[model samples]
Target chain A: MTSHPPAGTPSGIVLEHVTKRFGRTEVLTDISAVLPPGRIYGLLGANGVGKTTLMSLVCNHTFRSGGTVLIDGEDPAENPVVLGRTCFIREDQPYNDAFKVRDVLSAVSWFYPDWDAALAERLADRFHLPHRTTCKKLSRGQRSALAIVISLASRAAYTFLDEPYLGLDPSARGIFYDELLLAYSEHPRTIVMSTHLIDEAAGLLEEVLVLHEGRIVLRADADEARTSAFVARGLDSAVTALVGHREVLSERRLGSILSVTVRGARTADDESRARAANIALEAASLQELVAAIGIGGIGGVDTESFTTQRTSR
Target chain B: MTYARRSLRLYLANRSYVTLIPGGILVIMLAMSLVIGVAIGMATEFPLSAQIQEGMRENNGGAVYSIPGFLISLGALAVNRNFAMALAFGSTRRHFWLGTLMGFGLTSGATAASAVVLLALEKATNHWFFGVYAFDVAALGKGDYVLTFASVFVLAVLSLALGALFGTAYRAFGTKGALLTGLAAAVLVVAVTLLSASNKEIVGSWLGALGVWAAVVVAAIAAAISIAGSYAANRLARL
Candidate 1:
C-alpha cells in the first residue's frame, strides 16, 4: 500500500537551540544545526553523548524539552504528513511478541507512503531472515538486518539509522553498505546515520556532525573534518615545543616518546618546524578526530606533567 | 493509506489474539458447562428442565469473563508493542490512539455479536436439547439477546479501556507509576464500595430504578474515563 507523493521540494531539517533533559540530567543542551536536503550526514559522538537522543528527538519518537524541530518547514510531532516522510529504527527496535518477520514487514508496509514490497522481499532474502520465525527468536545480527530492510524499503524522505550495523558480521555489513549506497543512488534523499565505524562510513557522508557532551562541538564537510585536527609524535620536549600554544585534545606517552592530538590543521610553517624538530605531523583520521573530541573535550588542553619515571631494568 | 487506517490494520492483523483465541475459550467453557449439566441430570434422574433452571439461576456467569480478559490483555499488548512499532513506522500518537479506539470498538462489537448469536442458538436449541443453560444463564442477561449484547459490549469496552490506561501509565511513568495507579484505583473502588454499602437503601433504589441499564451506564462511564486517562498518559509517553 502507498499514498500520493509529497508535493514541492523538500525543505530539510532545522533544529534551533534544542534542549532535552530527563529529570535534571540534561541529555542534549543548546544543540542547533541545519541539515539541508538530499545529503548523507554522519552523526558522530561517544556513547551516552546523546547521539541516539538527538535522532529520536528529530524523528519525534521522544519529545524535546525545549527548542523547535522543523522537518520540511513543519513540526513533526504528531503530524502524520511530516512523520510519514521519516523512518527511524532504533538498535533495539521493539516488535510484537507474536509478530513473525513477515508480520512485521507486512505491518510496517502500511505506514510508509512509499513502501517497496519487492525491495523488502529482496533485502529479507539477502539477509536470510526467515519469514516464519518470530522476532524474539531472531539473532542480534538478524534483528539488525530486519531493521535495515524496513529502513531501506520504506524509502522515506528523511531516513535516520542509529548504529544500524550493531551485530552484523563483516560480510553482512559490507552488504549493508553496498545496499545503502545503491538505495541512495537510485533515490536521492536526506539520510543521517550514526555509527562508530567512522572511517568505514566516511566515504558515504558528505558532512559530519560531532556531538560532545550534549552539545554539537563540530559540524563541517567530511573533507574539511578530516583535516580539522593533526597529531604530533616524537620526543616529549620536541613535540611539546612544536605544539606551542595550540589546544591539545589528547596526549599519550610511551617511555620518553610522546604523541599529542592538537586541534586545527597543520600549517606549512608548522610542518617545516615539525620536520626540524624531528616530530612527525599527520592529519587525524575521522575516527581519531571523533575519539579526540569525544574523549578529550573540545579545546581540552593537557597541562599535566609529561615526565616519565624511569624503572629499574 | 491514512495512518489511523494503517494502525488499525496492523493492530487487528493478529486474528488469533483478537478473535480466535477468545472464541475458542468461550466454546470450551460452554462445552464444559454442557457436560457438567448433562452429568448432573443423568445422575440425579430429576426433572431436567427444573434442575437446569435452578442451576442457571444460581450460576455466577463466570464464563463471560473470558472474552473481556482476552480483550484487556490485547489492549495492553497493543500499547506496549504496537504503539512503539507504529511510531517507528512513522505513525503519530493521535493517529495511533484513533486506530486503537476503532480497534476496541470493532473487537467489542464483534464479540458482542458473537455472544448474541450464541444466545440465539441456545434459545433455538432449547438449551442444547439437554437444558445446559450456558449462554442463557442469569449473569449474561438471563437469556435476553439484546441485554446480553449490551452487557458484553459495555464490559469489553471497559476492559479494553482499562488495559490501555494501565499500559499507557506504564509507558509514561514506568513500573512504579503503573503500580501507584493500580493502587489508587483499588483504593477508589474500595472506597466507593464502602460508601455504597453504608447507603445501601439509597444506592439500591437508584440502581433498581435504572434496572439493567444501570450496569451498562456505569461501565460506559468508567470506559470513557479510562479512555481519557489513556490518551493523557499516551501524550506523555516515550518510545
Candidate 2:
C-alpha cells in the first residue's frame, strides 16, 4: 500500500559518533554521519560489517555502547513522540504466532497513525498472501512480502529495512523494486535499506555508505562513487607511466600487458594522454568499485597501490 | 491514535487466545456438569441432598476451575514474541507495559465476573443439583455471594499481574536467568515452609488473621508487582 508521507517535512536521522559493542566485540565504531531527509540511502557493506547493527542503533532497537543517536534531532530511546514516527522491519522480525495475515495488518494499522489499509490490502493481493494464513504458517518468501507490505503501508517518516529481499524470487524482487520506487514517489520519506544485491539495487540509491570492519571507509553520491576511480590497460611501461603517483585500487599483469584500476577524476586531458600512451581507459561501475573496495584490505596486498578515502562524517 | 490506545489494541490482539481458552473451558464445564447433574438426579432421587452432603464433606466444587485461565494469561504475556514486534512497529516501552497492564485488567475482570456468576448459580441451585461446587470455595465464598465475588476478582487480577511479572522477569533475564530466579524462589519457599513448621500454632493464627483481609492484601501486592514488572521490562527489554 502506498500513500503520501505526513503533512510536513520529515526530519532526518543524525548519528554523531555512534558506537555499538556486544561484550568485547565492537560492531560499529565511531560512526558519524547525517542521513538527510527524504532520500534513499544504500547502507552497503559485506556481511558482518555492522549494516544491520547500524540500522538497529539508529532506531534504538538495542542500546548503544557509546555515542549520540538523534532521530529528528531528539533521543529516541523510549521516547514515544519520536519513535511513533519511525518503523524498523528486521529480516528476522517475529510476529505473533497466533496472528493471521489479516491480523497483522490490523495490528499495524492500529499502531501506525498513517497506516493505509487499502494499500495493505492491495499489497496482500499482489503478493498472493492468503489473509487467513497464520503468520507461523507463512513460507519464507511470503514472510518477506508481508514485511514489505507493512513497511510500505505504515508510511513511517523514517523507515529501515534490513535485507528486505532475503527470500524473494527474481520476479518478486522486481515487484519489490517497482513497488518501492512507486511508494517513494507517491509518499517521499527517508528510506535506509541494507542488502547484498548491490548491482540489482545500485540504480535505486541516491547515495551510498560503505562500512568495512566496523568502520565507514567510504561515503559519496552513488554516481560520484562509481566515477571516483577508473581502470587503464596498456603495455607495462605505458600503463605504469600513466599511473604514476595516482592511487592504484587494484592491478593485474598478463604477459606484456598491464591492467590497473586507479583512483581520481578522469579528465579529458588524462583520457587523451592515456590514448597517446596506447592505454585503454574505462570507468569502473559502482558494483566494481564496491567489489574492489571490499577486496582491498585483505593481507594488504590487494590495495598496495590504492589510497582509500573516507569522505563523510 | 494515542500510544496507549494503539498499544492496548496490540496487547489485546496478541492475547486474544486468553478469551478463547476460557470460553471453551466454560462451555465444556457446563456440559459436563449438566450430564453429571442429570445422572445424580436419577440415581439418588434427591440430587440437592446429595450435593449438600458432598459439599459438607469436601467444602469445594468447581471454584478453582479458572486456575488454568490465570496460567494461560501469564504464559501469554510472559513469552509473547509479539512484544518485540510491537517495538519494531513503533510502540514505546511505556505504551507496551501500560497496555499490557490494561489488557490483563480488563480480561481478568471479565473472567472474575464469570466466576462470580457461576458461584451464585451453584449456591442458588444448591450446588447445581449434582453437589458440584465448581465456583464455591470456602475461603472465597464462605456462603457469602458478595465476599466470594470480591475474593475471586482480587485473585484473578493478582494472577494476571503475577503472570506479567513472571513474563517480564523471563524477558529481562532470558532462560538462564529465569532458571536461576526459579531456583532461588524454590529455595526460599522451602526455607519458609521449614521455619514455619516448628511454629505451626503461630503460623495458623497469623493465617487466620490474614484470611480476613486476604483480598485487599493480594490486590495491593499485585498492583505493586505489576508496576515494578513494567518498570523492569521497560529498562531491560532488548529487541
* Most accurate candidate by TM-score: 1
> What tens-digit string does per-residue lDDT give for candidate 2 at B2-83?
7877767876774555544543455566567567656756776654465555554355444445454654466445345567
For each candidate in turn, the interface RMSD (Å) is 0.8, 1.0
Candidate 2 ranges beyond 4 A from true positions: A1-10, A232-242, A250-261, A269-280, A298-313, B14-16, B26-62, B65-79, B187-210, B219-223
Clashing residue pairs found in predicted model 2: A1-A119, A32-A313, A248-A305, B51-B131, B61-B133, B62-B133, B62-B134, B63-B134, B78-B167
RMSD of 1: 5.6
Per residue, candidate 1 scores C-alpha lDDT tens digits across A12-43 of: 88888899999989999887777889999999
lDDT of 1 at A235: 98
lDDT of 1 at B33: 77
lDDT of each: 0.84, 0.74
Lowest summed lDDT across 10 adjacent residues in model 1 chain B is found at: B44-53
Per candidate, chain B TM-score? 0.92, 0.75
Output DockQ, candidate 2: 0.75
lDDT of 1 by residue, B1-239 (tens): 36799889987989667765655667877788777877888886533668556766568485566777777887888888888898888888888888988888887887788778878888898877766777777777787788889988888888888899899899989999889878977887899899999999999999999897888887888899889989998888888
Stretches of model 1 off by over 4 angstroms after superposition: A1-9, A299-313, B46-49, B58-60, B198-202
